[model samples]
Target: MPQVFKDFAILFKYRNFLELCFAVLVSMLGFGLIIPLLPIYAREMGASGVYLGLLTSLFGMTRSITSIPGGVLADKIGRKKMMVGGLAVYTVVMFLFGVSTHLYHLLILRACQGAASGVVWPVAATAVADIVDPKDRGKAMGFFSMMWDAGIAVGPVLGGLAAAAFSMAAPFFVCSALSLASALLILKRVKETHKKSEEKPTVSLEGLSFHKLSLIGICVTGFTVSFAMGVVHPILPLFGNEVIGLNEASIGIIFGAMGVTRFLVKPISGALADNIGKKRVIVTGLAFNGVFTTLISFSESFTTIMLPSVARAVGLGMTMPSINALVTSMTTKEKRGRVMGIFSTSRNTGLVMGPLLGGFAFDALSVRAPFFICGFVVFMGALVLIATVTEVENENAEIALS
Candidate 1:
């Protein structure tokens, strides 16, 4: 390996990060299983469209609602212990999903699961951030994010297949088993990356509330763009079926192709974010995202969609790592968990709000409404990037050090 390549390998060689990644990947698998199954699963119990949307948003809402508290808990209790507890709760709630006979039952269970999920991700990311050197932090986080995307990608196919070949319950069962199994692995294999025994900083609601103003801007830009993009989401398969004249298989192929861009670009972008500058990567990524996102909406043919889809894929993959890495980089060791927790919460807020606005824009206007909205939002993100934030070098990470 090249010297630089060898350096990255060392970051992974630390057994604890891999343990954490394994746990996250497994948890994501369970999450992936639910994405394709949620609507149908609810419908099987007599839920209406409005009800289903509510059920869907329940998870996002809970995740958003509980994230800051989860962070506060992680900072208090420590990351590894919090992760284990969160995963255990996730497994139990998912199993409960299998036993539920009513839509409301599903909603309640899903909300609890959401709270647990909210706790796990940011804490895990912070744990990884704590252990990895600043030089390798972006690359490490990229790989972490890539694993998640890969899990979600692989999840739907397996979930859909299980739903078809065996039963709807099959996917849920598989998810539960994998998650609990991952939790055990985490408990056994992962060491505490952030030891609580260290000189723990005095917990302050004031400083611990790191990056609130910045997060507010990020959330606004995220919600505006993502909400617009989400409108096209529900319409994509519909467009393929009704207008574009494609079968389920072809639609899947196109969707899968576009999704590939996200995983492919994340790690490379992470490394780039650390190397060049976090804010620059964030701004450029959003700009690139704006162009490709526009192209995807306007694309006339399946082949044309691929062009912009690839661009959007790479853009998101790059943007996520840069944005998240930058966000994580700005805070301190003691307050890192809480900062990331709140950041993740803001993002989940966008996730819930995006679909609603996107749907309204489409039903009242046009099928392609979301794309235009997404493009506009990305432009706003670019503006936020330019006006508000400044770039900091990763190697000289003294700013983040206590």
Candidate 2:
């Protein structure tokens, strides 16, 4: 544990990386505020299962569409510029979310929000890749993920309380304010990490044949994992509320528990991935995550649910930083932005389908059907990873280490 803290502490010396972390941390806090509330909010506005899934899918659809372009643009323009611009748009979208009355308004706003995120997250990840060494990339990403999850851990409780004390609209307003602050912070504090690519910034994968198999494997793994998450997101809170007799506050606490477990686990998991192997950590994590995801269906009450939920967090915490590090280690700096963009696009594509299918399963099949299906899909993804991905040296890894 001390070694983990030391490794994380070592990363703080990078000023640009630290600035990015702070910006992401603040932005995610706002993003997390809505996680447990949005579907329920849509439901209250008369969204049926399919319609609810559509709302989530619209966000993924727009995000998937924009992610590649966003990555290409980041290589051409600048990471800092793209990130700030996206955050500025997010500020507007969140405020609009506060004022939205009809379900259609949310649909449009969610799409817009997705577009902005498509720009923001991939670029930020590319920047992290640019700043860190290949060997330490896992830890760096783990710390980054930890910071993001920390905000997520706290945001739900605060959002729930804010809703209880004021109104459902209150969290959106607060989210808007935080988005504006994050944008301004990035604009002022973060440095541009990459030189503009001298070659024309086309989003082709022609030159990456050496890493092609690994890239494809990672993207597939990312898509399946995200798809499983997308399947759960719109329905999990609803399951707690409608079937388990929990209130919004209790739902928020459950979400918070998941986040807290992620926060505690990610840094150590990242370090573990560095010492062992990224592929091993990812496979183990996915299987564990899949098992717990399936188990959530059997929980009768809050206490029963918490075990699986937190265990799921542990699996994810182990999985994501390793995935980020593996992806970073697969490509040269020149193509990192576009590669990250492609990966994010793939994941978003899964997200686009998962929610719609999950909602259909929830309403059309059975309420617990999404969980069972999600588990099966994710476990298959882990198997897919074992078959396709092999850890290999990036062309520039030794050079980076030197």
Candidate 3:
């Protein structure tokens, strides 16, 4: 425990951790708050599964599609400006999401909002990776996972309760407040990693396409599963309400528990990945996750869900950090921000798609069918990685960035 505490303290010692975490918590919390509310709001507005899937997909589609450009921008302009500016747009867009008059309008806003994420995340990741040593990427990735776990833990339950108690719109407004706070924190507390005087783009040794292959595959894996996750993020609450007859508080608790399991195991997974190897960690974790996600569709009782769903969460927690560490291991300080931006964009793009696909599945098929589809995809991703996406053996391996 003391060693754990000491390691965590070292992460805090880095200024990048402070700012990067600030951005993640604020941004992810805002997004998390809105996720549970999205289905409820859509149903109230008479949206069908297809429409909701379109909406969810629109968010992912926009984000995923723009990652390469965002990566280029991080390389060209700088990480800080891109992130701060994106957050600024994010704050405004979220407020608009709350005030949206029609589902169509909300759909458009989410797409545009996805762009902000596409821009912000990669830059933030790049900034974090910029300062850390290559050998320590596994540890740095663990810290990164903690930030996400914290956001996931707080966002859904808080948003669900707020929606239950106040209104669906309440969480968005709260998210906006947090965004404003995060923006201010970035402006004040964080120092820019790249300065104009110091900005010099260097060509990476591995070349962009090949160097980032594994990471890109990880991105695709993330996106595909997230597409499945999107189905659940919005519909699960609806399932709990309309099908299972649970209250919003109950829904929040269940989702929050998923986050808790992920949070609890995330650090351990990252550590294990560091100790073992990224490839082994990823394959095993994804396999466990894939199997359990399918089981989520079968969950009729809370007791039935406890272990299986928690197992799925643990699998997810392990898979993500290992993949991240693998990617970060190949990046360099100069190209750090841009490459990271690409990684973030890729994963979030999947996130954007998940909702749209889920929404569609809910309308066209059964509410639970998408989970099955997602599980199958997760299995395929595991197979694909095992087949093709070989992990980098050497930490000092450099990729061609230009």
Candidate 4:
């Protein structure tokens, strides 16, 4: 126990880690503030059916398109530079979201927002990977995840209140301000993790030979989970409002409940992944998420909906840290940014497809159809992971570089 405290003390001693956590928290706060409200805003702008899904997918598509390039730039230029630029873009785009008068305006702005996110998330993840020891990566990532979830937990309730009290545009303005503040914090407090190098790190298939198969498996799982999420994202608010008869505030509470569950569970799951095995925790989480996400469709009331959302949060908390740590374990520090970029791309791919498919399903079949299909997709991903992925320890990770 004393040693554990000491370890945590040492981890916190890194100034960059603390700053990164702060940045992520603030940025996610802004992001969460807007996410639940975006679809409604679009619907109000006369977007429906496939257009609604396209609105969500455009953001993901742009992000997915830019992620690899952003990763390469992070490795080439630096993490801090990429992050600063991304935040600047976020500030502009979010404010634009406030004044968006048409579906086309939203489509353009969301695409830009995705591009900014492409730069921010993968690079920040790499920065975290750089600062922490390999053995403690899961815990470090868990802490980071906790911060993000914490922001997400609080943002929606506040956003909901602000929107109800004022107007739909209010949250976007507030989020823009928050994003600017986060950017300033990054510029002032966070140091560049990637050092300037004359000889660039070789990023080839050969370098990843040791864990190529595992990486592919992880990416596949990432896609599945994200795709499932995407399928639900655009329609959840609508479902709550139309089907479950929930108000904006009530819907916000449900979203907050999920975030709260993730915030509370991530640290514990991270510790478990480190002490037990990542694969075990990941498999368990995936199964839980698959089951509960499907159950969400059957929910008739706000209370019933919260149960599955909370359960899904637990599943995500368990899966995320382990997957992040696993990916980091499979690659060298120099190539970490690009590897993370690939991982982000995989997630974005699902993000892109999910809403598109969900929109179609929502229009064609039933509001419940997307949920059932998404649940099945996640189940298949879990099966693939169980069959193909093997746990790679921190001790063995160094050998992968050779």
Best by lDDT: 2
**lDDT for 5 (candidate 1):** 53
Residues 1-402 of candidate 2 have per-residue lDDT tens digits of 568667867457676888888888898899888889998888889999889888999989999998999999888887999999999999999999999999999999999999999999999988988888777788888888988898888888888888878888888988999999999998998889988877787666776434688789899999999899889889998999898998888888888888999999988888888889889999989988999999999989999988899999899889988898888787778778888899899899988999999999999999999999899999989988999988866546646633
TM-score of 2: 0.97
> Which ranges of candidate 2 are over 4 A from the true structure?
395-402
Badly placed stretches (over 4 Å) of model 4 are: 1-11, 200-204, 399-402
Backbone clash total for model 2 is 0
Q: Give all TM-scores, in the order shown.
A: 0.84, 0.97, 0.89, 0.96
**Cα error, candidate 3, residue 47 (Å):** 1.2
Model 3, 1-402: lDDT tens per residue? 655666676476676786687668766777767666777787788887667767767777787666657666676776777788878888998888788778888888888887887777767766776666665666677777777777777788998899888987888888887777777777777777764434554333354433566666766666655655676656667766776677766766777787777777777776677778888888888888888878878877666655677788888888877776776665555555555656666566667667666777777788788778778878877876776666664443553332
Model 4 steric clash pairs: none
Ranking by TM-score: 2, 4, 3, 1
Which 10 residues in a row give candidate 1 its minimum summed lDDT? 197-206
Candidate with top TM-score is 2
Q: What lDDT tens digits, residue by residue, belong to model 4 across residues 41-93? A: 88887878689899888878999998888887888888999999999999999
Which run of 10 residues does model 3 get worst, by summed lDDT?
201-210
Q: Is candidate 1 or 3 superior in TM-score?
A: 3
lDDT of 1 by residue, 200-294 (tens): 54434355434445555655555544454554454454445445565434454554554456666776777777778767777777887778777
lDDT of 4: 0.86
Model 2 poorest ten-residue lDDT run = 393-402
